[model samples]
Target: MSYKSHTVLLIPGIFDRGSSLLRMQRALAEEGFDAHYIHLRYNSGWHGMEHLSSQLMAKIEKLVKKETTCTLVGFSMGGIVARYYLQAMSGINRVHKFISIASPHYGSYWAHFLPYKGGKQLRVGSEFLRGLNQSVRVLEATEPVSIWTKYDVTIMPHSSAKLEIGTSYEVPVILHRLMPMSSKVISLLKKEVITGMG
Candidate 1:
């Protein structure tokens, strides 16, 4: 019954080496949770979403064999990756909860403006991105919690930060990257994790 025994998989956002979640992971560990980080490499390249989603699914499959249950803590694009994995892969059933911080559940305007070969792949208006958002909405309906931030700069048109059917929190002062380390964000995550376990 010790929730601390559950492992937390920390997925980092676009172009992030997973270093972004290090402080938060350590803090979670201090609170008696087992935390691990996944560094997604193709957040800015062609097929970035596909590549990361496949990698995350593989990791979840591997973890399912050893852990009874897990929680996914995804940041920004990482949240999209986690949602896709849960929806498309069967390994996600082993997960007990999901927590997203500053994630673009509905796609982001920044992707529409970025000048890159794969930039269009992230556009909120793109057919692919819109479809992915729909899938995430369905997943949120069945998951424990889906947290978001209102002051995110990366996911402009802040509405992109919302999920369909879960508790949504709006922290008014933190930016996108800073969310993973913000005290308020951490507290929210801690509360969600505890609630999920209970």
Candidate 2:
């Protein structure tokens, strides 16, 4: 269970690219950790979760061949996707730690308000999110750490961003979009990473 040399898979939020997580990936690399970014395509009308999850699982399978343990760094919707991957996929044994930043562990209120052509079908936090949360809660409780932010606007009601069990970190001032690059947030994350790895 010594986690010092484990590979970290960084997953980005919704409507985002791998470049969004580049800074953090570089930071982790600088710390002498193996970091990989999962780039998912948005605007596939939200039906891309299966495809994206499959891609992630494939990458993880490859990593498992080399390492005994891995860590997942998921932000926002990417956290949800990570949860789904852990719950539904059979290849999650390689993941030793899971850290979520500003993710909607519960359903988000803003998702109900956003106007999309496909509406609830095209976004998270609808009935799908509610069910996803229930499932995630069961799976996440087995993980080592689950981090959250308090001042997130993207996931309204703020409470939606909390984890029901496991060690949760609540940062007071950072917003959702800035969570990836904030120095304070990165510092907090490094601490959690060390804690989880231990």
Candidate 3:
């Protein structure tokens, strides 16, 4: 596909008021690329990970048409949600590039306090995470990229942000929430977006 046809779909973290990723969306748009920030109906994920992913699939189906794929930019819980769409919802066949920022791919200690169904899934060693990890190779064709910070407190063991598959970048950003807005992170993301268009 041509670079002009490249579309980026950005998914925000859990419990978003729906504007958490506006800055990232604008950055992509300012770069002259087509980008959309997808808001989840159940952002708090009170239902569960599967339910959140189902919502993601529906939004993606509306945005991406047959024979055309888009790059996905997911932050925090949104990253895992996007992955469920890719790994389990057959989204891998439709998505070419996967970029996750400050996501807890390996589950997070912070989730221990979350009592919601979706929150429970984010806890360390949850069945949901283990299942996703087991089938992560499904994303090999997409050459996933994970961006994280060494100082993230939201995701305990900060190393949990690093993916076991594909490329991972550890930026010097100070916080997890800042990953999507940091200039350094955005610059690298721009490069990744442009490169995959080839």
Candidate 4:
């Protein structure tokens, strides 16, 4: 598919408003790509990840039924949610590239700080995260990329952001929330988006 025909679906992190990804969306649009931000109502992690992923699939289905498969851009919890859609809900066939920014692929210790059903699920060694890792063991069709910072305070052990199955990039940024908006990060992402279309 040509880069012009490519679409990007951006998902925000847990408890984060979709507007958090506004800068990235606008950057993508300005680059001549059809970029869209997904607004998830149940922002708390308390809801089932798969349930949320299904909701995302519904929105994805509505957007690219006949068009080229989209590139999935997920930040933090949003990355995990997008992974659930890909690994558990057969989303690989619908997406050409998968980019995760500062997501906890291996459960985070900081998750224990939050007191919600979703937080419990994200805690280190939670059944949900285990299941997610198991599903990723068999992932196919789409190429996955993980982007993270060495100084992230949100995802403790920061290393938890790294993935074992696909490409991973460790950046020098200091905060987790700024991953999506960083110009350096955006440059890397733009390259991935264009490369994945091939």
lDDT tens string, model 2, 1-198? 423345888888777776768888878888767889876755232564556677778878776554476788888777767776777775456676787788776757766664653235324446656666566555553364555666777876677777776677777655788878877667766776666576
lDDT of all predictions, in order shown?
A: 0.73, 0.68, 0.86, 0.84
lDDT of candidate 4 over 1-198, digit per residue (tens): 422247799999988888778888888888788899888868786675776788899988888765458889999999989988988787777887889999998888989988877788778888888988887865545678899998998898788898887788888888888889898888888888888877
Better of 1 and 3 by lDDT: 3
Best by lDDT: 3
Residue 83 in model 1: lDDT = 75
Candidate 3 structure quality by residue, lDDT tens digits, 54-151: 87788777877767888998899989999999998888877889999999899999998889898899988999999999999998888899999989
Per-candidate TM-score against the hidden true structure: 0.87, 0.82, 0.95, 0.93
The local lDDT score (0 to 100) that residue 124 gets in candidate 2 is: 49
Give the candidate order by descending TM-score: 3, 4, 1, 2
Residue 89, candidate 1: alpha-carbon lDDT: 64
Segments of candidate 3 deviating more than 4 angstroms: 1-4
- Write down the RMSD of candidate 1 (Cα, Å): 2.9
**Model 1, 1-198: lDDT tens per residue?**
312236788998888888878888988888788788986667663575667888887776676455466788888888877777777665455677888887777677898676664466666776656776566544653364556666677887687777766778878656777888888888888888767676
Better of 2 and 4 by lDDT: 4
Clashing pairs in 3: none
Worst lDDT 10-window in candidate 1: 137-146
